[model samples]
Target: MIGRRILLAAGVLFGAAAFAQAQIDNGLPGPQPLDAGSMILNRTLFEGIMDRNSKVRSASAKPMPAGGYLSYRASSKVRQKVTREYLARAEKAYGKPIAEGLRKTLGAIDFVATWRRLATRDGLRTGDLGDSVTAYWAVNWLVANGKENSAPGQMQALRRQLGPLMASNPGVRRMSEAARQEVAESLMLDTVVLAIGADTAVQKNDPAVLAKLRTTTNDRFKQAFGIDLTTVTLTNRGLAKR
Candidate 1:
């Protein structure tokens, strides 16, 4: 089983990607509902986070330090503690679901690998059309990743290469905009599906977690993408519905 904290934390960061406003508000179907057990897992993990009498809000509340990679290192200790608790709760609540989600996400398409393969086919790199397309895909991927699974070192390299290209070329900027939007939509849909799945797993033992997940997911979507998912109705008046 995946560490509950890692799973929860990852979900909180990347999973929220499902409902992150930027990803969702493009008039997309927000995060899809998870299976029954997954919802329970999401619910329980969140409850445990909130139950602790500490500085952090619930695991689902958006850890202040773990909100993005930029801030992750700043509060490593606190985040680690939360991560442990989150994993613990997840283990007790949902076993396979937690591990499965991690594997799927961690294994999801490798942007860099695909780019390299495609680039070689086109014979392009560094200050060439191929480079431009690569940068385009990369930026879009980073945005979709939305700070989760975002390795600072990898992002730095990508930025070092593409930053100047976009800054120097108006044509490239214009060319990439549409592609970026399309990628954003794809990511949003993916995120929605994951959130729906996780929420479904943990909604039983932890109502508070369920509620926080709904609010955090909704708010992040609104803030990041400007997409609104009205009210999602679960078996009961679960958070996602509203």
Candidate 2:
């Protein structure tokens, strides 16, 4: 369903900007890359994009569409402003030191383009952008770091979490099967982001950020899909290979 949201959202962003190829940073020479650290330390990733999108669309003479992720909406003025505000929020979300490090990393990155890729054609063909990419990064770090054993999961997690909601909301039936599946899967992606974000926060010695992340994440989840993740059991899952 996330893809449908993205596709529908794309109506406003078509012919907007270059879609970036997201990759795990290899410390190699390139335009910019998002490795594990960037993903972890910069937890307000989506918020920043949304802020830019809202700012840009509001600035546009003609009405700009707003259904999905389109942070790369062109607006020279708002780019840096969003970045600055985002960093301030980041400092609040992750502390000053880590935020400073993120700033150094951001220096070389064109985040607008990168954010657009997450919800556009540049997103990998195999899966929707938010879930696939977020899960990959979140799980990659967890599994690679041997935290799979400790990785958190939502009880009736993403997929399971949506079951009741879908049955009640007949409007969801209008969506294609692929879209529904993607939407369900996308919920798990949010869990992964929260899990990884919490883990990162703990490691950074600011364990408090986890609660805030969870609250905000649930709010966003509800706003996006009209389901409340707060009621779900958030524990661990048997994450075996599919």
Candidate 3:
């Protein structure tokens, strides 16, 4: 009985020592690294860091799909190449030191749509460029032959792009009227080109989509610029609207 009692005592001591050693070796840290700043900083810095990180992620993220095209990301190099091309073409087209609002308008073409078009039809290799110029050259084209209310979506898309400058833009709220009008005027040139330049072989290949694209652009142009494109006559001993 004494021997058994001694064995029990020894076992208890052994377990107690083992547990103590484990407690020393396997103890969790009471204060984590992030916890050091969490008290006074309250994580806002961390949250902002996360938010900024997300933007970095998003700049190259796979974009949403549009039309019948597969979506892809044009690499930084390709985007930079296109930007250089755009700047060069734009400089040739509209002289040096491009106006801020006009540059903004041109640069805001749907990247997702642009990338998709490049990938699908333009033969853009992975992370390489197709015709980057065409991406922003005209995002959604408007058929000149269509009715006034025909191309609502195209106009809407243009209007949406135009909005940032229109009162910062019109959809958001009213801001500087003069500045807004100035920006709108700058955007109008693109509108005019689209009105005259929308007929394409690809567009004709898909007639139904082309039709919707037509109607959508018509109403949207009117809605966007308050200018009925169908009625623009280029007056002054002017050209006739054929």
TM-score of each: 0.24, 0.30, 0.23
The residue-by-residue lDDT of candidate 3 on 1-242, one tens digit each, is: 00000111233233222322222233211111112121112233323433443334222223222211211343445344444544454445444543232344335553334334322332222221112211221332224334322221222222222222221212314323332222222222223223222333122366654455455554553443333445432111111122
Off by over 4 Å in 3: 1-73, 97-100, 106-141, 147-242
Each prediction's Cα lDDT score?
A: 0.31, 0.32, 0.29
How many clashes show up per model?
Answer: 39, 4, 13
Give me candidate 2's TM-score against the actual structure: 0.30
lDDT of 1 by residue, 1-242 (tens): 00011123454445333332222233322321212122112433433322331333222222111111111111334323333443344334445455344334434533223333323332223223323322333332322222123222332233333233333444434434333323322332243233333334253345554444445445544444332323321111111222
- Tens digits of per-residue lDDT, candidate 2, 1-242, equal 11111121232222111110000111111111112222112324333433443344222133122113311223444345445654565466545764565465445445433333332332222223233333333332232232322222321122222222333333543444444333323333233223334344444454344344444444443443333433322222211111
Error of 1 at 205 (Å): 3.9
Q: Give the Cα-based TM-score of candidate 3 against the true structure.
A: 0.23
Poorly placed runs, candidate 2 (over 4 Å): 1-73, 122-216, 219-226, 230-242
What count of clashes does model 3 give? 13
Return the lDDT, model 2, position 28. 10
